[model samples]
Target: MASSNNQQPSPNTHHNPLFDEFRWVIQIRHSLEEDHDDDIGIPVSIFNVPKPLQLSKPEAYVPQLIALGPYHHWRPELYEMERYKLAAARRTQKHFHSIKLPQLVEQFTKLEHKIRAHYHRYLDFSGETLSWMMAVDASFLREFLQVYAVEEEEEGKALRRLSSRMSHLVDYTGRKSAHNVILRDIMMLENQLPLFLLRKIMELQCSSTDAADEKLAKMVTSLLKELSPFKLMENFPCIDVTQHAHLLELLYCVIVPQSDEQTEDNEIEEQNDDAGAPKEGRQSYGNSGHVKQLFNSVWNVGSTLNGAPVRFIRGIIVSRPVKFVVQLPWKILTGLPGFSILKQPVEYVFSLQGGQENTKVSNPLDASVSRPPLVEEIMIPSVTELISSGVKFSPTNGDLTTIAFDVKTVTFHLPTVSLDVNSDVILRNLVAYEASAAMGPLVFTRYTELMNGIIDTEEDVRLLRERGVVLNRMKSDAQVAKLWNGMSRSVRLTRVPFLDKAIEDANKYHDGRWRVKTGRFMKRYVFGSWQVLTFVAAILLLLLTGLQAFCSVYTCSRWFGGVMNNVQKQN
Candidate 1:
């Protein structure tokens, strides 16, 4: 009312707290709208490690040397690395002769919204602060990753000349412990920088776009090969570095190459062709299908015995009168003096020769015609147990796809794995990354679980090392055992068809042995139920004691005699 057309209003008129809050909410709404606009089409690839995953081995997931992204950027413990990061940023600036550090930061500021969208968690830093952080982190990462770059002969000299500060921190030869620790930090789930930012930095440093792409790809590939536990084969597929989210994702792609279903079908077909299996039987049996067909031919004669004479003999043998007559001869032969030994031999020979002819006729209708039960879990024996059970362990110079179990030779083929102090950290982070990002099967996680299952004790590690399947760079076999055991604590059960099939084959082979069968029977019947059997025995002993005590007090013999006499009199 303008204070009633001239009268002054109180100063508190517009000072209502409720009104102030409403305006503040409007401001917040606009800010959120802006944020939503920035995140419209961007997909989040980086994630803060879940608390449950961190709780098992917090050090493995947390960066020990440097903080790469916003997730752990403010941790006081990692603040010491800030000076080094700044030094590396300065060194990186020298490489871009025309583009200065400030210009690089400006470019990052322009991409701030895009950078924020990559992280799953909310970033509380202002645009300027976040941009500066990305610039510095990307610079530091670029400098460190230079050591792993595949340098050409012309550029090798220039690439080898790292700054004095970085030289102490990152050894070109990767012999220093500090260097290894930084490498581990770079591979952590939380300490990941977006690959786009790295690409932008590389593009700015290089002469042209194609050169930057080529250099980045080479650097990433070399880094993966250096850090990977599995030795990459010569024919390993090339990975598109730009397509990945970060270094960790690129490394995962290198380790677990995605093969299409059609390719797998083709490989199976090729293997069947190598084994000379018929096309019609190819799908039913696996690698050993040809061998099964060969064994199946042993009973094929039964099919040829389907004539009238064979049918008449079968009908006569099935008659009840024939069965009675057959039993009379054996009974009479066994009853004769000095003919009992001959009776068993004659009966055994006749049964052996006749049983085959009868059994083969019914083979088509036998229970063997039914499909075997499915193996739900991968339940292979430990390394030591397999060796003791006469199952052989051999290292294959191929990828995870090369894991095979030969039934005839009782051999288990596994890929060679090189282990070191940082191997556990690398493996744990890969597993965590896969859990967060994978849309298909967790093949790497399944592989880790397989190793954990087969390595129960130090002796198992020793046996694997002896066979060159596990290259142990740790202090002892016990350390290797402990590392695998600790990794399996948070692992969830998963099934990879090929790995599971290999495990099933190994278990079947192990179970088929007489010693293993005997041991299983003893464990299932004797040791497994010892407590219940003991309780039943105690109850029986107690009842017997009570009966003896009653006999001591009252004459039980007389009681039984009187009952018997009464029964006889009644009869």
Candidate 2:
């Protein structure tokens, strides 16, 4: 009986799903251990664009024509580019006599775990699948980027002419072409290939590692120069390619190079002092203390004489009693029928002066204690507003770090930027990459935000364009304005102290103008209290009307005359 019971089939004889999961985990652990020694400390550079940013401009972050990495490699829409990618791989293999496509794939497979670590998201594909995808994508990318290579080698020229299928895609003849779309795709954050893979592929074709790296650098520089909106300098800083995770990162390093250890605040202070104040030596003389005191006394006397009348008039105008008298008529008119329509426009004009009140005190300590905490937000006016406030705009040949405000000239110096159809995609992707990487300071992102703040409408764009600060290749000023305005949605609020200082100086210069101050005073004291003033005016009008009615009905003057006569007789 016991033998018969043992012979029965066990209930757990079939395969258990848990065992399969356990084996998979073990395999992954082993792979990780094997590659742990070879880890290059590459962070997850490739990221799915954050949902907020993606929702704002999905086209900027997602691949439109082709997908390079495994993130979007499986999308059916991008799969159509697979055949061309394979062709590129085939042509790339032909360049190297010693290595075949399968050999490249095998090399990539060996480094699969290391490659996977570069991506933030988990790749669901097997090791072999990821290797093949990377190899093909790297080959395609290398072939495409060669079109923009600064120095065209025999291999690049031959490859360009040999592949008829790739000719249309690499043709740089027209402004509008499939080539441009592919260029945009490659710049997308999700559609990036590992730079190491590209270097490996290039190394296979070149004579030596040094030759491969040289060609790769030239190719990347040329690509950046072509795609970057800002002009690249003749002696652009040389960057180590291996340190960067991908092409976008390499491009960012070139554009917003890591700043020095010197803090931005200190640099700004130095610039402000240099631009605004006279040199220290000019104010000093070898034994001239008495002469200095005499000069200062004379200067103070002359200044007082020159400014006394102007200050007296300003004081009278800004005085509360005078403001009330000036506003009384307008307030009364506003309450009348058909005059109510002017109220909103009047209020709006006045609202602009809300923050211009004088808060300074005689005591510095009291002022400091009572002063509001400084807000980190940047609140500079628009370009048109700045220009209207007597601030001038000037285009500069320098980079982003060169932006400055010339206090003497009252000029806002900005780096010249060329705008075209591709500008939007390039700028958006750069900002997206910066946001994702969490790099030290988002210099480029802050630059875009600065532009967005300054350009509020087509008028601002036109002004910038006319000033040569903006080179608009787009069809209309409206489009350029729209492009910049749309970008403000995805950017995080950040304070780049240097840029902020430039803005601060410009605002101070603008606000210091007499016209601006007067306008703010009018808005704050006169127009800002329209409602209360209107109510008072209405009540006064009612009391006057009653007085007139009483006088018309009775002889009020005769009644007061008789009362005065009676009082005089009693006295």
Candidate 3:
């Protein structure tokens, strides 16, 4: 009894593994419940970069020049940008008459809870720290946009000072510019300020007038325009800007707008739908249909499925002419109405049959009908193979809406993409955003995937360069190929049927067995050298001549023997 009182009880008394595990399970469940209770609202748009994708290419997803949001706000590498942020904050204060920087900080401080709810990951900063970060970022962004918004005369002094400050970031002989890197960083998916702050800041800065809304729109549009490679900003359709969540969403809307007409059409189609089956014009191109389309492309080869000989057309006329010599002539040509008329054919040819058309045709090549569901896999010929197969590649007018593939013409139209130092950064962020967003357009992702499949080697890059499809500003073609191939490391593709169908068609045309066999035979034994073809022709001619001579000799011998035998018998 004394031993039982003084000594420890049996080791199994309180050391049950099952009980320990059960307690752990309860603790985990309680923690998860606490986390769920802490979450106040639904986070739909902005998201942290998935671990797999981030791990694959961390540098591309992470910002280099600046950190605009809380995700990278505390990183040691981004400390250099903090001074610039402070400078931007000081500049931003001058823009506001009523609200000073401290007042603005106070305003964001009051809305700390609301702002924190937007981020997907748990931010580690306290409320005060979080608000301060938001205030600083918001102020810098406004000033940055304002600098680009105002005219040269209005912002000349500011621009010069800004340039002076930024000059240290880039060397004079360097391939990249500081401004481009900043633009790329700002466009990153995770490094975005909340749209509410942008609007509120704009409101505080605007005059008390109805033009305030238009003023805000114009400012945002101009800022986005200066950053984009495509200058079609002016043509962007009016959208409810209030629906946008951030700069990335605004940029996306400007690029791939869901027009009111399209919305009405979708509604009408939905109303008319009878069961789960799609209507005549809206049929989904399932696996079977995709295969048939592929077969058709291969079967037709250089022609359409209906046996019509297709005409090849260049999408954009590439001219890096001797500028010193041709500039004067080009300027003169530009002055003429006839020259403008000639230019219209190339610029507006694809747009005439763009997605706005109303007709519903069964043919995938017809632009009047909705495009078929893209193939399950993305496939296209390498640049070298496409050139060898007689397919032409030309640049588009920097608008992705112009991306089209005409199997009838055996031509592929792509945007005149400038492959600068920031191209990879800009493209990858856009892809990451698309992957994260609930319904982000997959246009950019599909384009990169298509480019990756086609640019497998340096030869492919050379061919693309020659065709003016890729204006590679980088050091080498291998670098260009590597940039694209690495972009799709962990990307998940959705069904963008038109893009899929186009790529599949291109692959089918290039990889068709019959076409491949014929090309090989011509390139190897016959077209290997002119001498080989001449030798084969000579051998065939000699053989034919020898056979004719042999037949003639045999006939003469038989006739002579028969005549001799008849004469002898008669005697």
TM-score, every prediction: 0.67, 0.71, 0.60
Pairs clashing within candidate 1: none
Better of 1 and 2 by TM-score: 2
Q: What is the lDDT ranking, best to worst? A: 2, 1, 3
Worst 10 residues of 3 by lDDT: 307-316
| Superposed model 3: Cα runs more than 4 Å off | 1-43, 160-176, 209-216, 229-234, 237-241, 257-377, 465-468, 473-478, 519-571
For each of the candidates, give the backbone clash count.
0, 0, 2
How well does candidate 1 score on lDDT at residue 121? 89
Q: How many clashes (backbone atoms < 3 Å, residues ≥3 apart in a chain or on different chains) does model 2 have?
A: 0
For residues 443-557, could you state the per-residue lDDT of candidate 3 as single tens digits?
Answer: 6667677878778888888877777777787899888888777776425434344565677566545544356645655675466756556756777888678657755655544
Q: 27-80, model 1: which lDDT tens digit per residue?
A: 567557764565586777888776656787899998997999888888999988
Displacement of residue 165 (Cα, Å) in model 3 is 5.1
User: Which parts of model 1 have CA positions greater than 4 angstroms off?
Assistant: 1-42, 150-161, 259-378, 489-493, 527-571
> Which candidate gets the maximum lDDT versus the true structure?
2
RMSD over all Cα atoms, model 2:
13.5
Q: Which is the leading candidate under TM-score?
A: 2
The 0-to-1 C-alpha lDDT of every candidate, in the order given, reads 0.72, 0.72, 0.61
